[model samples]
Target: MYVFGDSLVDNGNNNFLRSIAKSNYYPYGIDSNRGTATGKFSNGDTFVDYLGAWLGLPAPPPFADPTTTGPRILGGVNYASAAAGILDETGQHYGERYSLSQQVINFETTLSQLRTMMSGPNLSRYLSKAIAVVVLGSNDYINNYLLPGLYPTSFNYNPTQFANLLLNHYARQLVALYSVGLRKFVLAGLGPLGCIPNQRATGQGPPGRCVDYVNQILGPFNQGLLSLVDALNNGSHPGSIFVYGNSYAAMGDILNNPARYGFRVVDRGCCGFGQQITCLPWMPPCFDRTQYVFWDAFHPTQAVDAVLAHRAYAGPPSDCHPINVQQLALINFL
Candidate 1:
């Protein structure tokens, strides 16, 4: 898989850059097989990691990693970066990050390297079978438009207009990926941003309740994205299959019925104080991590990641629209 988007899917790509949005530290990978952090922002693996294993492929290496050269390219490369967004200026506060456009440019570099090993039909066939997983846009709201003090987006455009701006740019970027030979895509929509610990702790809602205003703003973007999926598949790109992963509904199910998913803590994270800040380095996380929905103020725990991955992999239409990842994998449009 060729992964894109923000920290939700980022697995060490930000570590290589001079960015504060990094998680290559203690207590981060406390549940991994090695119990050593490899820059994934969770107690164990991200959903993308689980999805990779489900597909029988090794976790794609970070594109910026020094070892991501030669034969390693065959396993795919992860270009996801923490704090990244659809807009170029979205995460400037965090220093360096690969925006969607920059990630595609980096993919072009990867494609150039692949051409050295395979050309024409071989390269096209290889790319056609690969899945391009894009889970972006949250940062555009969390890091950019919402930060009215740092950005003028809120002053310029309303929520609906901002979402449209994001979708317009995103559509162009996806088409760019298609032009480069990617035939399969998993376009995950934005989730309930208001329900996260950071937003909940802002004192914008009733005690222990989600910030409904924040969640309401994301509806237009998610609905428009589902429409974009239909737009792309209906002959916009021949043989291309773009599936919409409904992250909003998938996460909402877990939040609404935490007990059903074996989660005890729904309003806070297992590590930090469940405030605005993230978990500190070497901080001791909860021993019963499986009982918590969030790992940090913003990211979900490995347990939650596992559930979301399972849903996207084979769940019904409520989780993955049109077709699940398993169905996408079975298709050979080439």
Candidate 2:
């Protein structure tokens, strides 16, 4: 599958790129079995890594790797980068960061190279069977709209206008990909940003309470995304499309009932003291990461990633239906 978007989906693109938004160094993946940093924002494996394993394909390679060649092209590659978003200016206010458009351009370049290595039939089969998984837009809100005084002041765009702009651009990009050979798609919407450790630390809510404003923006984003997917799959787009996953509700469920998911701590992160500043820093290390749902301030722990991936591929209970990634996977989109 072609995995695209930001750090949430990035396996190690930031490691290759010379940027501060990188995690390919010490203490990042020190807890991993390999003992070497793998470029994932989290401690060990990511949700996409588990997804690739479930699909019976080798974990997708990072697109930034210049040395990758041959049969590795069959499974797919990840073009995601840290701080990338649906628009060129999505995260620019933060600093130097790759935009989502640039990531897609990288994806186009990778596909061009892959075409030279595969036979005609192989190429057709690969596109026919492949799935494009896209997870993005969180950083745009966190870094661009909320952090920087862009939307609330400079542009005067509220959450709704900003979300519409993001979705519209994202739709155009997806449509462009459809014009190419990409048929199957799995578009993942943004997860609950308000409930994340970072936001919780900054906000005044109780440990378990989700911030209302963040949820307010996320609801419309997911709704618009779902509507767009439905419109695309209605015979206008080629092949088939699926939602792939619903990270928001699933994460909230795990947080609300940590015992059910074998987690001990949902409020405090496994790393740092769950404080606003230290959670995003590199100095203070988190203590027993496996026991907590969140590894750092923004990302999920390896254990939670594993469970979320399993549920995404194997289906969740009825109450979560269309919101479940597993059920979305079973839609027979291929």
Candidate 3:
């Protein structure tokens, strides 16, 4: 599969690049069995890695890796980067990071190189069978809209307007990719931004309170994305295009009932904290990260991610609500 988008899906694109939004070094992957970092934003593996493993394929390589010199093409590659979003200003606040557009351009370049390495028929076959997974838009909301002061006046745009502009451009890119024989796609929707530790730290109300205003925008954004996916699927596209919904409800369920899913803490992060409620140097690391849902102020622990992934592949409950990342992957089998 061709995995695209931001840090959520990035295995190590930023790690190989000279970008500030990187997770390629020490202390990041300390939780893993190897206890060695692998460029993922979290302490362990990502949903993409889990999904790929479930599909019986080797985890996709990052597009930025210069050493991916091999012959096998059954597995795909990831072109995602930390803090990359649909807009140029998405990660400008942090400096010198490649935006989503740049990542797409890099993906095209990688595809070209792959085509050169393989015969025409082989390349065509690979493209026809491969699935493209896109998971993005979080940074656009978190950094661009939430932290717009860093950008120049000329690039300023509100959250709703910026999201619309991004979706429009993304539709064009999807169309272009469809024309190139990529038919099957799994488009991941935005997750609940309100529940993230960073947002929780800023918002008011009871502990573990979610910022409803920020989450309100996500519904409309996701609706627009669903419409886009429906349009693509209904058109003369070669393969099926499916929308994978992730957001408010699924996250809320897990947060509200942590015990049902085998978690102890929902609001407080697993990483030990000191004076600062947020997980940072001021705080001490948690004794056991598996007990908590969140690993840091922004991401989830591997244990929670595993459960979420299973739910994603398992499909919705009787109520028809969306499942987690795991259930989404199972749709391929269905």
Q: What is the full ranking by TM-score, best candidate first?
A: 1, 2, 3
- What are the per-model numbers of colliding residue pairs? 0, 2, 15
Q: What is the lDDT of residue 273 in candidate 3?
A: 52
What TM-score does prediction 1 earn? 0.99
lDDT score of model 3?
0.67
Task: Give the Å error, residue 64, model 1.
Answer: 0.7
| Candidate scoring better on lDDT of 2 and 3 | 2
lDDT of 2 by residue, 70-176 (tens): 66766788888887788787666445556767777777787787789878777766676677888888887776776755644226667778888888988888877
Q: Model 3: how far is 160 from its true place, Å?
A: 3.9
Between the candidate structures 1 and 3, which one is better when assessed by lDDT? 1
Q: How accurate is candidate 2 locally (lDDT)?
A: 0.73
For lDDT, the strongest prediction is 1
Best candidate according to TM-score: 1
C-alpha lDDT (0 to 100) for residue 326 of candidate 2? 45
| RMSD values, in order shown | 0.8, 2.8, 3.7
Which residues of candidate 1, in runs, are more than 4 Å off? none
Candidate 3 worst ten-residue window by lDDT: 274-283
Instruction: Pick the winner on TM-score between candidates 2 and 3.
Output: 2
* Superposition TM-score, candidate 2 onto the true structure: 0.89
Question: Model 3 over residues 32-128: C-alpha lDDT tens digits?
Answer: 7688778776667776776666666677888777875455434677888887887777777565666767766776777777877889877776676
